[model samples]
Target: MINTFKKDDAQALKGIAIIMMIFHHCFSSTELYEKYTISFFPFKENIIVNIAVICKICVALFAFISGYGLIISYEKKKATASRWALSRYIKTFSGFWIIYILLAFVNIIFRSRFLKVYFGHGIWIGIASVFLDFAGFAKLFGTDTLLVTWWYMSAAVVYILLVPLLYKELKDKTWIILIFSMFFLRVILSHTDAGSFTGSNSIYAFIPVFISGSIFATTLFFSGGY
Candidate 1:
């Protein structure tokens, strides 16, 4: 009883997610989006909002895909955790740091007040602030004005760091525990002031969805779908 999953199907789903994300961004702004809200389009606002909501799922899809891909790779390669971490860190951070350096240069040339406004300290403090922003701690501290969208990188890194621990300790029950813990944390946080802290972009919000992908891959393998 060999169960087969099509790579093409997965790729197609990713393509759909990408399209949804693009549509979400396109409809996010008023000036450019007004063209869709004109006379002929009766339920334009509703449709746009629905699209925006649906597009939020794309983030989960991305995290799932990442987890699935990494788990599958780990299964195939049987790589050591340290090796994997080093490789992943180099692969992930190299491009980001390169871009960050370029942006820093641009900021310096333009004599941008961004650092002073955000950090409000001397050059050493400004450098520390930049590092914090790059590591995604600035967002937690409410100073993530620089590269605000890069919070995903920090969350991904945290997940990557957790992978070795999860793989070692919860090799069998990863899915169940991850799903349960995520919901439990969500419920707990919702009752407290931390509820506002666990928005869609945060690491805590995405961990369950990401680990679900690993579970899916594991199930597929056991079910002879690999």
Candidate 2:
């Protein structure tokens, strides 16, 4: 018998993750988040805070889904790693590069007057910064300057590149290692200055989650359970 995977549930999860992300962002700016002091009769302020915290899990969910989906695709297509990575790179960065180019032109034409305010740099610097970010060197050195969210894309790219090397060796025990390593890293980082900058926005911070998802995909496929 041939085993085929149905993606309806994955699609539903993606939709839910997107909604949660939007809610998380919206609530982040509200007084409930600011004060962390809002409460009802039976619930405490920590409930509200916890809800906001849970909502932020959408970022991890997205990364997990990306890793899961890519593994599934790779299995189904039986594509070479280089070809797969190249295709993924183009698909991911083509649109991003277009937008980046447009933004660069706008910044240059405006003499870097607008983006400079937020990025604290001129057009030339902005272009260079994005290149550094895309290469994943900026985040490694704690010098990222593109945007807070761009970390996701950078991390995803790094994960994709590393997948070819790590998947076969680590796929079976991903969950165990991911959980332990991430927890240990969290504990270590919590007491360090670099922790403040890493947050949930760096490749190192999300690699475990991504690998977990990839392992899940591999398991589901090999077990014919998906």
Candidate 3:
């Protein structure tokens, strides 16, 4: 397919989506940065749920944008892509653990879950699970969740794992199937779970979102002239 969507518009929409995610996570508003941003939308409990729905779209959309950016980056240089992939995996693993460590230290020092408010449990076990996502321990061990955003990083790891395959064989049809399957699965899971599939929502349900990101990344490759 031709690059029909306006590049500028897509970029703008991506910007909007990111900002929305930030707001949804931070203040749980699409843009609680300003008082008037959600002035039109009702500000009730249910309304907040509605706002979060829109924010989830922003996250899914951001995953797509991430895929778009990464695929294009890989296409530009093979050696660079390989290095980038390794570096990304290392970065994600290290980054998650580093944050987990800091958060655990802070929690031990403060003896408060307030830091836990944003992140989550951060003992040694949480530290390991948060970074490695080695769920093998999550059942026996506990979760850290110091930064709720760790979920995003966890999802990123999954998307990264698909890069080699996407760059090689699945760049075309496999990606399309992933995109469709994920979208459909998301709907099914959402209805069954009564919405919300972030952490432990479905025995680690980042697969759909991760693949969706790949689909978005594929389009970016096309639009980027890669």
Highest lDDT against the true fold, candidate: 1
Q: lDDT per residue, candidate 2, 1-226, as tens digits?
A: 3454447667888899999877676554456356465444586655654676578778778877777777666656467889888887778678877775676678668676435543565667666666676554466555545455665666767877866755654545555565586678767766654253223555666566676677766664434424
Best of the two (2, 3) by TM-score = 2
For model 1, residues 1-226, the per-residue Cα lDDT tens digits are: 5555445656776898788777666664456567564542666676676666567677677777766666655565556788888787777688888887787778767977566545676777766777777655665555544666677777777767767765653466656776687788778757655454323556556666677776776674423333
Tens digit per residue, CA lDDT, model 3, 1-226: 5664445656887899878776566555445445544443545655665665557556666566666656666666547656878876776567556666776678769787634443454466445654443322232233545544545665565567667777664555566666676678778777664256432333335456555545654565455433
Candidate 3: lDDT of 137? 25
CA deviation > 4 Å runs, candidate 2: 1-5, 29-50, 77-79, 98-126, 133-146, 170-199, 220-226
Question: In model 3, how large is the Cα lDDT of residue 4?
Answer: 43
| Candidate 3 residue-wise lDDT at 157 | 59
State how far residue 189 of model 2 sits from its true place (Å): 5.5
Question: What is the Cα-based lDDT of residue 46 in candidate 2?
Answer: 57
| lDDT ranking, best first | 1, 2, 3
**Per-candidate local distance difference test:** 0.66, 0.64, 0.57
What ranking of all candidate models by TM-score puts the best one first? 1, 2, 3
